[model samples]
Target: MTAEIFATTPEGDTVEIVTLQNGPATARVMTWGATLQDFRLDGTPHSLVLGSPVFEPYRSRMRNYGAVVGRAANRIAGGRAPLNGATVQLETNEAGRTAIHGGSDGCGYVNWSLASHSETSATFTITLADGQAGYPGNLALTATYSLDDEGALTLEITGTTDAPTFCNIAHHSYWNLDGTPTLGGHTMHIDADSYLAVDEHKIPQGGPQPVAGTRFDFRQPRAITTPQDDPKLDHNFCLRLPGTEMHPACTLRAGDLQLEIDTTEPGLQVYDGSGLNSEVPGHGGVPYGPHGGVAIEPQKWPDAPNHPDYPQITLNPGETYRQVSRFHVTRI
Candidate 1:
C-alpha cells in the first residue's frame, strides 16, 4: 500500500489517500468518508468509479461519490423510527422530510482514522457518539478494503454499539465502466424478484412488491435506461432475509468489461444516477450528469426500523453488525 496526504478538511484534519494494488487492479481510498476515490484495472484506460480530483467537490457537490454511507444508510420516513419502544427523531437532511444516509452529517461526510494498512488492504475506523445525529448508542465502526489476486475488491464493515440502535452501512460507489457521460448502453442483471415501493418522498410505502410486469424487473440482463415518464431507479431490490452467507447480488456489463457483485446483505439498492449532476469534473475530466454512473449498494432494507416485517437493523450491546461485499471485474 502507498499512502499520501490527499488534502486537509475544513477542521484542519489531514486526509490521507491510500493506494492498494494486487494483480491487475488498483484502488485509491481516502480517509474522508472512508471513500474509494478511484478504481482501475491494469488494462482499463479510465477509472471504473466516479470521483473528483480535488477534495472540495467531495465536501460540496459530490459528497456521496465513492463514500461509505451511514450510521444507517438509505431513507427513514419523516426522520422518525421506533427504537426501544420510543420514537427517535433523526436529522431530516432530505428536504426536511426524510433522513438519508444517517442524516446530514452521517458517516459518509466524516473523516475516519486509518487504523491499519498493508500492500493490498487498508482499514479505517470511526466512532459515533451516543445521540449524535439524533441516534442512540456510542457506535464504533470499521471499514476494511482488501484486494485479491483475481482482481476482486472486498469491503468488510463491522459495527458495535454500546446501546440499542439502528446500524446499516453501505459502500456507495458510482461505477462507469465505459468512462462515458451516461449509462446509455450498459446492461445490468440483478438476482431479485421483488423491490420496495416508495412514495413521492422516496420512503417505503409498504412491503416488498413483485418486480414482474413492472419496469423494476432486471432478472435478465437488460439495458439500464429510463424513459422520460418511467420512474427513476432508486429502489432496493430484495435479495432475501439477512443471512451470514454471501450470495450473488448483481452484475453490470459494458462492452468487454463486466462487474460482478456478491454480498451477505439482504438487499441491493440500485440507483441509476438519475439525480447525479455534479459541477466539478470527475476523474479524467469526465463530466458528470444524469445517469453518469450507477450505484449498487448492499445493505439491510431501508427504513427497517419502522417496518416490523423487514429485516431488523437494531444493534444491541453484545451483538456485532457485519457486512461483507465483493466486487470482481473481468473481460467478458
Candidate 2:
C-alpha cells in the first residue's frame, strides 16, 4: 500500500497514482482525474494505462475528463429537471440541444476534496450548492474505493440532497484484460436479455426491447470487438433483473484473467470507447485510438428523469441514495 507521485507532464501538473498490492491483485490509481490507470488481476493486467499525452477522441474533448461524474452520471434529456414541481434547466455540453453528462464544468470537471486516502482505499467528497448545474437541491456526494482480499475492487457512492434532485455517480474505467495493444481480444458476457433502444440523438426511444437475436446480445461470451464494430458499442442495456441486492452484472475475460462486474444499478451503459479524440492523449505513451478500451458503465438508465416509463431518480430530503459497483478479477 504505497501511493507514488508519478511522472508529470509539461502542463506543470502533478499526477499521483495509488498502488495497492493485496495477495494476487495489484492496482494503480491516478489522481489526474481520480481514475483507475491500471489493475493487474492474478498477474494478468487490466485497464488502459495512462501515457504522457492522454487522448480522448470519441469522448475526446472530455474523455476520462473527471475523476468522478456527478449531479447526474448519464445524460439529461433537454437538460431539464422537475423538482418540487419546478422545472430547472441544466448545462448542455453536447453538439445538439440534448445534455450529455452534465456540461463542460459539470461534476466530472470539478476537483473533489480528497476526504480520506490509504494504501488499500480512497474516499472523495464534493458538495454541490443549490442550483449548481441548474439542478434543484444542494448535494453532498461521496465515493469510496476499496480492494478486498478476494481481489474485488468495490466502489461505493452515496449522496444526500437538501432539496429534491436527481443524483447519479460512477467510476469510468477502461478495462483491457490482455494488457495488450488493444481490447480486441477480450471476451465479454452480459447477463442481459434486453436493452433500451435510442434514437439518433442517443436518447432512449421507448421501453426495453429483447436482445434474443440482436447484435446487442451478450448472453454468451464473445469477443468484445468481435464484429467489425469494435469500439462501437454505445448503448444502454436493460438488465434481465434489477434490484438493490448484489448480483452478477457482467463478466469479462482477457487472456488468462477473468473479471466479474457486479452492481446494484438498474442499467449498464456500454460505451466501447469509440470516440477518443487525439487531444486527451493515452497511457504508457500508447495511442488511445478507437477501441483502446471498453467502458462498462453501470448505473441508472440514461435520462431516467425524463422518461416516466423508466425508473425515476428522484431523491428527496432524508432519503439516503446509495449505489455499489464492483470489479472482481481472478485467474482463469
Candidate 3:
C-alpha cells in the first residue's frame, strides 16, 4: 500500500490517491469519497495514462473520475418527483430532462472525508446536511475501497437516510483498459435478458424489453461499438434482478484487460462517455482530452421514485441501505 498526492484542484481539496498493489493488480483510490482513479491488471497501466500525442489533457473530462456518485446515482426524471407519497423536489441539471443522480445538490460534489485506510482497503464516509437537497432527512454515506489478495477491486457503499429519500449509490470510473481514446474496441456483456425502453429524454418509457430482438443483448458478449449498437451509449439498463444480496451484473473488457463488475443494485447505467469532457481537467493533476475513460456505473434505475414497479432506490428510516460493487480484474 502506497499513497501519492494526486491533485489539489477542487480548491482546498485533500485529494489523496491511495495505490494498492497485490500481485497482478494495482488500484488507485482518491480520498474524495473513495473515488477509483485507476484499476490496472497485470500492470497494463492505463488508470492514469496521459501525456501522449493523440491523448493530451483527457483526464479533466472524468465525470466521477474515480469517485463515488450518489444519494441517487442516475436521473430522477426532471429531478423533481414524489417519493413515498412525499413531494420531494430536486434541482434539474441533466439537460432539463431529469434529475440525474441526485441533481446539483447531489453527492457528486460533496467531498466525503476519509474514515479509515490501510494496506488493502480504504473507507470514506460523509454526512449530508439536512435540507441540503430539499429532502428532509439527514444522510450519512460510506464507501469502502478494498483490493483482495486475489487482485480484485471491491467498492462497498453503506448509507442511511433519516427521511424518505432515494439512496442508490454508485462509483463512477471511466475505464480505458487499452490506454487509448477510442473505446470502439471494448466489449461489454450484461446478464439481463431485457432493457427498459426510454424516451428521447433518456428516461425509461417501458418495462423490461427483451434483448433477444434488440442490440441490447450481451448474453453472448460483444464489443460495445460493434456496428449493432447505437451511436451514443447512455441508457439505464434494466439489469438482472438483484435478488437479495450482492451479485454479478456485467463483464466489461477493453483489449487485454477485463473487469467483472458486480453489484447489489437492481440496475446498471452503462454510459458510453460519448459526451465526457475530454476537455475537463482531471485529478491526475492534468487536463484530460477526449474519451479518456468509459464509465460503467452500477446502481438502481433512474427515476425509480416515479416508477412504482421498479426496484426502490429510496431509503427510509429503520432501514439500512447497502450496495456493493466489485471490479474483479483479470488478464486475458
lDDT of 1 by residue, 56-120 (tens): 89898899999999999999988899998999999999998888999778999989999999989
Model 3 regions more than 4 Å off: 3-5, 9-11, 48-60, 242-244, 280-292
Candidate lDDT (C-alpha), each: 0.92, 0.71, 0.69
Worst 10 residues of 1 by lDDT: 239-248
Give candidate 2's whole-model lDDT. 0.71
C-alpha RMSD by candidate, in order: 1.3, 3.3, 3.5
lDDT of 2 at 139: 89
lDDT of 2 by residue, 162-212 (tens): 888887776677776666756778888998998988877788888999978
lDDT score at residue 137, model 2, on the 0-100 scale: 82
- lDDT, model 3, position 4: 62
- Winning model by lDDT: 1
Q: Between candidates 1 and 3, which one is better according to TM-score?
A: 1
Report the alpha-carbon TM-score of model 2 versus the true structure. 0.87
